[model samples]
Target chain A: MWEYLNHKNGNVLAVKNLRGKNKEEFNYSQLNKKITKASKGFFNLGLRRGEVVALISENSPRWLIADQAIMRIGAINAVRGCNSPAIEIEYIIQHSKSVGLIIESRSVWEKLSIKNQIVENLKFLIVLEDESFGDFLGWNTFLEIGNKNTSEQYEELIDKCSADDVATILYTSGTTGKPKGVPLSHANLLHQITNLACIADPKPGTSVLSVLPIWHSYERSAEYFFFSCGCSQFYTIPKFLKDDIKQIRPTVMATVPRLWEAIYDGFFGALKKMPKFKRNLIRLLIRNSSTYKKNLRKIRNIDLYETSFISKLISLFLVIKSLPLHYLASLLLWPNILKQLCGKNLKFPINGGGALPEHVDLFFESLGVNVLVGYGLTETSPVLTCRRTWCNVRGSSGQPLPFTEVKIIDENNSILKYREIGRIFVRGPQVFEGYLDNTQASLEVLSIEGWFDTGDLGFLIPNGSLVITGRAKDTIVLSSGENIEPNPLEIEILSSNFISQVQLLGQDQKNLSALIVPNMELIENKFAEKNLLEMNQDFEIKKYFKSANKLFIKK
Target chain B: MKLKNTLSQQINYLLKNRSGSRLEEQIIDLIFVEPFSLENNLLTQTLKQKRKEIEKKYDCEIKEMYKKQIKGEIII
Candidate 1:
């Protein structure tokens, strides 16, 4: 987009490279030139306005460059992370009927089942990182095509591109479904650009650490928002997140719930290596501060569940009693801990794309970290409600964005009263027009009046903050007619330190059973003294089953 | 009308190539209805189909689909 090139200070670093081999960084003006050349290159390659381009790549600066290039030429791109199953990428490319493809690398492209067939069908192919393979163009050669031949036609086309024009199609292959293309228009994305300031409100040169996959709507919109505000984004993967946090000293970060759990686990890991007295002292201070913070929140009515008047009165007394401890921890202890953990610059962190585990939310809050959680689906341009920094209510995704109306409705389509849980129906400018090609699916979710059923169950508190309960469609219905939301149960199972992942079964059966992936390292290490690893070598599963049985019963 | 038939033919070809017999995969019978509306109970306010309502409304047509399993015709 021309707007991606239009930041006030073009000299400020825009995209920092942690994934790159050389650790390159690009200023706004440099980013602008790459976009310009790439857009021209794409145009010279016969990619006309409104044509579809399948851009499959993982996290890298080139991904952003390719994306802006496609967009600037008034063409739409169907994006997916190349790490996703090759079949899924094939489905997206074929179903989207793309004219061209901008692939990540040769090694990645080799994974596609029928690469030659796909290449033969497309008008052109450009590999982002590798040498031009056979007839495919490399990133440099493609850019040179535009460099040698000057053209101002792409700029004119950008001016002609309307807000209603479909910008990108992101395939949302949710847990158990076929990939459906969600076509988001320019207007849908622009809504976030203008509106995200209400919660983020970061100054122009804010340092942002990006960890989530940018192909998803949540992270893509965040990238667009941060880019618009001229924030410097340091890109990294989950493996390097802890190191990058210290290295970048980011003032802002966007995250998902699982990453928070990992960080919390790492914190305890570091504490284990400290001197016993100092560790014990730090633990006591953490406990004191947690108690103080929770009590203060109870007084201010920022709790997950209800507390009686007497409890609130007791909380008031506890708040007063803990004042000294709170002050000691806040003034002396936490600043150092925060600096070590979040690099002394974490002003506010954002969480979206999934519900943050309650314990993780409280852990950061206790440390005086402002973790703002937002909620929406991919179809809605992914942000309907977000907790504001100034007026955050713990456990609730805060108020709706400006002009966004969120309604909790029952199966009968009647709006539920406040605090009554139901499916969330949202009507907003950010909501997409329709899914590409699949008219039946589009009609199923989006009403004629523009309301989109989010398929998520949530209730609104009196303060207009939304507390999400669970997924409405993801519920397990038993033969006995009992309904159970499996997400919370799965989360409960996942809380066991030795269990890595769990999925609840028995959708139409009498009882439930779970398929779990054990945290093998922890189990083997802890059970090593018992000769468990040596004994389990023959039938490894039996050992885990026995361990799970022992651990499950104990819990 | 021609474009609709062509689109239908394209879809039928895709289905046939994936799996199944020609008779089973081809577009033998179809109907066009107006876009689902909230005014009728066919569509929910958020536009999801009321399955029971749609079944109730089109009971005869659904029965006809079962009966027509033995035969094929192209109305166009």
Candidate 2:
């Protein structure tokens, strides 16, 4: 990363701030300088190799600077978004044994409210913003400390960082009602950086808009890969996504499925309000193009669940029949739809974090934008498989990477053949060492034979494209791409006196719902003993229906 | 009805305390069903709730809840 940064000496934009009204841009040289000074600043604060610093931040220029600076000084970082649950953040800090904390702001710190309790041996704290942070270092003050000193053997520190050294620790919502820290080494990340270039292959100095939380392994790996290729990255929030897409005219972008869903839903809502004729025309064009694309995918042998020769012949006939209208849609209507959806230059937008909803997938691609879908967990540096241009299957997370091996196994731990649904396991250089300080948890997923169970149920097509079916584990993924580990929520709810047993549901749904068994004894006591009402099972069940509806309406 | 409101009150309190979170983990609605036991496949032999089985069994009820929501039939 340092070498690539040094090589790109020209005045090209490396990183830019796209938040509302905050215009900040840094070229490669300037970014290099900020990171170098920050590294010196970390050094001045007595941070050294193998020391862990916890970064609780969102997407910002300083975050990129701090991330590179921490790595440059031969230290490891444990990163989580500022919006994470306070207990989850505290667990990461406590478990990682982080010495220094680089927080997002004073409010994030205050929200944690657990200053020295979790981090008992804490040394220092740095706030990312420029506020009157009393008794703690502010961003500018920390940089000033760096500016005052640079005589240390920083080059030696860089040389000491080997491929096997742990780079970052990311916490994932484990099935065990706690977040598990996945420690990724430099080699694990580099495998992503080096091999992911084949996915998009963004040109140097081209624009790549980022909207995901920068600390997330998916976003972080994309940032590293794009920045290494010298692509300018602009960070934007979800609220400003549409405006930023038009303004930045990004050629490449990487984001979560939720953002894509938002864009699709936004277009859906807007189309409903459009004039009747215009809406009809747009729908017709989209239908024609989507049909052509779908048949073309089958003809190209990229369509999953359909492999018969008759299907291919039918697809071929349909593709030829629909080609002219499809071409017209692509030429006239699609260009405008693509421009409105992701901008004219969005050639290679990748979506990850969870399965892209089929509607959202076909919706975007119907507009002439090829949205690539990738698959992996944080333990594999977040990307084990990705759909490419040639192998762009509608419902599959393309083949494994160059050195990555993916297979499916049944309940008995036997490998399954193609198209057989089972748990997915991966073996690759990008796979992490293990869970931090939790060998038992690590042993549960990882095998001595070098395969790591992904805990996800999937099957490989004959062409080796991976289709994720469902989860073998307990994590519920909402349609918005948020992963909710139901165990903790169930445990918290079970403590309520009114509930006996609970199972949180909402896989691919908008919000979470639950199957609950009421505590009949407590409920009957509360109503009958209070003389408010006579307890009867049928009447109580009717009231339960009413209460459930009322609760939902309150949402 | 009282049992459901009591649980919602507690959950609402939890959500209130966690205001600035990106996505509030609120249980939009819940269904009152028979207790999950070993006999019902909704609970494992070891007594862990079989979430997938529960979801599959209550699929119609869950969808009805969401449909009720969309139709503005649920009153607060």
| DockQ scores of the candidates | 0.01, 0.39
Task: Supply the global lDDT for candidate 2.
Answer: 0.81
Determine which window of 10 residues in candidate 2 chain A has minimal summed lDDT: A530-539
TM-score of chain B of 1: 0.53
Per-residue lDDT of A46-149 in model 2, one digit per residue for the tens? 88899999999888888989999998877999998877777778778888889898887888788776776854677778988656476568888889988875
TM-score of 2: 0.89
Evaluate all candidate structures by whole-model CA lDDT and list the values in order. 0.74, 0.81
Model 1: per-residue Cα lDDT over A1-555, one tens digit each: 444445585888889879754366888889888888888888888898899999998767888988988887789999987676666788888888899998888877887787877877788998888879877798889888878674677667778888888989998753222478999998999998789889887777789999888888888888888888888889898788888899899988877766676677678778878999999998887777778888888888767667789999999998898889879788887888888787888986888766666667777887889799888778878888999987788889898998899899998989899889898989999999888899999999999999998877899987788988766575553322233455544454455555554444433333344433455566555565554333323234345445756766675
After superposing the true interface residues, what Cα RMSD does each candidate give? 25.2, 7.1
In model 2, the Cα lDDT at residue A451 comes to 94
Docking class of 2: acceptable
